[model samples]
Target: MSRIVLITGGQRSGKSEQAEALALSLSAHPVYMATAHVWDDEFRKRVEKHQQRRGAQWTNIEEERWLSRHDMTGRVVLVDCITLWLTNFLTDGQTTEQILQDAKDEFDRLTAQDATFIFVTNEIGSGGVSENALQRRFTDLQGWMNQYVASRADEVILMVSGIAVKIK
Candidate 1:
């Protein structure tokens, strides 16, 4: 069976780096699914930095909000992070159920493809409770999304201080 790995950690926890490393170990070329939108100069610069780090070997695919079910196909596909993607979906006014359904569809598509998959996500639930309702909802959804993905993944890793701890 093809392996599906989920890497989750706090921001700047090197989850992306670790995901890339794991993708590199795969026998196939890595396809990077970048979900970040370059909305401003700072974000563009950050994206550039990430691109530079990944280098020219990776086949970069820009997938903003709600990746279509047909998008994930290659020898290995690494979704850089899912936090921004979730936020984009939420801000776009997608209902919670719709968001969950879309995510499930995308996950199914990835699993059905003949390729290894590495999903990177942020561990957003460990932070203190949010004061605002929207923030709280986002936090809850993020936790739920992570749980759903990890449940389906073959390997789940939590990164802390650049160290990976296998959770499942």
Candidate 2:
């Protein structure tokens, strides 16, 4: 069975760095799955910075919407983050159920592959309550998605201040 590792934390909490390190330890041919979409110049620069940081050792795949069901034999796949992926689905007029189903399908695909999966997500609920309806709805859906994925994960880690705390 493929090993699934879920890493989650606040922004700038070093989750991505840890995920990359774990992937390097697992396989030489690491696949970096980027799910972020550049909305503005600032965001584009941020994405570029991440890409530059990953360097040439990785086969970078930019997946903004639905994650592709690919065969990952002899590779370590790192999903840099899932929050942006969820936002893409949510903003694209997709229902929460649909988004979850899509993620479930992707998870099934990932699990079937002979690869070490490092899934990264953000801790969005920690920002307290949101007054906006869309924000609240998005947070709820993200929380649900995180719980569901973590349940299926072989290992779950919470990164805080660059420290990794294993929760499962």
Candidate 3:
């Protein structure tokens, strides 16, 4: 059976780092599925910093959209995030239902594969209420997505301050 892990936390809460560490521990040649899009200089710098942290051991796959059909083979796959990927889908006119469906489908597909899968997501709903409709919608959708993924994961971890706490 394949191992599926879901890791979530606040921004800069070490979720991504923990996810990477978990993936690395599983397999030597892990595939890093980076969902962030470098839309500006700041985002690019952030991506670069993450890359530097991962070093040359990770095989990076820069996927900005359409994550449902990616092939994860041979190596353990680490999805750096699901929220940003969902946000990109929504901003490109995809509905919430569509986003959820795609995410679920991808999760199922990855779990069926031969390698381990580690998913990283933000704990968006823990923060205070958003002041705008879009923000609220995104938070709600992300929270639901996190729950859905966690339900299927063999292990669920909540990270804070670079420390990992297993929730499931």
lDDT measured at residue 108 in model 3 versus the true structure, 0 to 100 = 75
Deviation in angstroms for 154 in model 1? Answer: 0.5
lDDT (tens digit, per residue) of candidate 3 on 27-76? 77889988986789988898888888987788888887655466775568
Alpha-carbon RMSD, each predicted model: 1.8, 1.4, 1.5
Q: What is the C-alpha lDDT of each candidate?
A: 0.82, 0.86, 0.83
Q: What TM-score does each of the candidates earn? A: 0.90, 0.93, 0.92
Between prediction 1 and prediction 3, which has the larger TM-score?
A: 3
Model 1 misplaced regions, further than 4 Å: 66-74
Better of 1 and 3 by lDDT: 3
* Model 3 residue 161 lDDT score: 88
Write one digit per residue (lDDT tens) for candidate 2, span 62-118: 887656556677678998788888887776687778878887777677667877789
